[model samples]
Target: MADELIFYTHPQSRGRIARWALEEVGAAYETQVVEYGTTMKGEDYLGINPMGKVPAIVHKGRVVTECAAICAYLAEAFPEAGLAPTAEERADYYRWLFFAAGPVEQAVTNNFAKFEPSADQGRMFGYGNYDLAVDVLEKAVSAHPYIAGDRFTAADIYVGSAVGWGTMFGTLPKRDAFLDYFSRLSSREAYQRAGAKDDALAAELEAAKAPA
Candidate 1:
């Protein structure tokens, strides 16, 4: 496994996004499940990322963080998976990746965190307002079958997962396009494999914590 990818992650966190991306790339990854009290907050892992976040990756000793960066890196690294776009597709690739990770994520987190921004559009925030961000995403997804237009690339994995999770938790609107796109993404075999593993892991963790 010398050429293997090592992913440090906790299932329920933003790590889910990376998990889906890893599966899409079909990369050989070894998941190190980080327990909350004992491992996730440990000093060693914290040094790898001072933020103490999971979803960090160490592939061939090269470290990468941030969900969108990880997704983009994997797509580029595993070109055989067809997840990466051609040089021609780069603009749309970067655009949607950052859009989902930045605007979409910020809007959902803020809605959950109950954050309110000033009404002024001049404020250059990740998501100026929740509704505005929703409108932006609605128009994009509705415009095409996937975020990067007709291509089903890693950008969809990133953006589709965000849409799926957001709508699942009731933060996002249940628009027809978002619903249909999420349905297609969720039906993918790779997505199912990754999701099943995380579900089992979560169940095991919960069982271990069950009252005696």
Candidate 2:
């Protein structure tokens, strides 16, 4: 069906976020695992996402890229999932969704790349600085059970993924707030289901690359 979602991802990439969102929405989708380097850069996948990034989804012949965007798109596409909030309740939803995708993302990437903006340049950086960015995020998650008010919307998937991956990789500070939020998200059946498949796939890929 044209309405079916076509998900393009790599097991070990941020594609895991999209997989979790897809599971939450109970969407009818098929997965295409793109290999790193040559395969991702090839004409086929590049046509879907010019950036050659994983976690892109094609639905109804339309394409959506970026993890946050995919989560939001899926939430709307599958209203039955109730991942989207009404307009009155959307302020926090949109706020944290973009915050995680923008500032939180900038902070984490800079940390991973070992680049830090000095205090003088903090005003120029979208995330101010890594420490400041993480502190703000910690406060946000600590104040609420979910990213968007009381409901577990798609925003949680994006922000929760950031916290979960950050704590696991030691990229983001493992503050009590982040730890608590991650603990809740990790226990969800959808999260566990998606993680199990990704973990198995990641192991298989790693084993294939190991010296025989």
The prediction achieving the highest lDDT against the true structure is 2
Q: How many collisions per candidate?
A: 0, 0
> For candidate 2, lDDT tens digit of each residue in 1-212?
53477989999899999999999998778888899998789999999999998989999899999999999999999999999978866998999899999998988898899898988777888788988889989989987898877768999999999999899889987788999998989899999999998899889888988998
The candidate 2 region of ten consecutive residues with least summed lDDT is 1-10
Candidate with top TM-score is 2
**Model 1 CA deviation exceeding 4 Å by range:** none
lDDT measured at residue 37 in model 2 versus the true structure, 0 to 100 = 96
Q: 1-212, model 1: which lDDT tens digit per residue?
A: 72568998887888888998998888788988887766778998887777888889988888999988898899888899999877777788788789888887888888889877777641778577898888888888877777777778888888888899888989898988889989978889989988998999899889988999
Candidate 2's C-alpha runs over 4 A off are 206-212
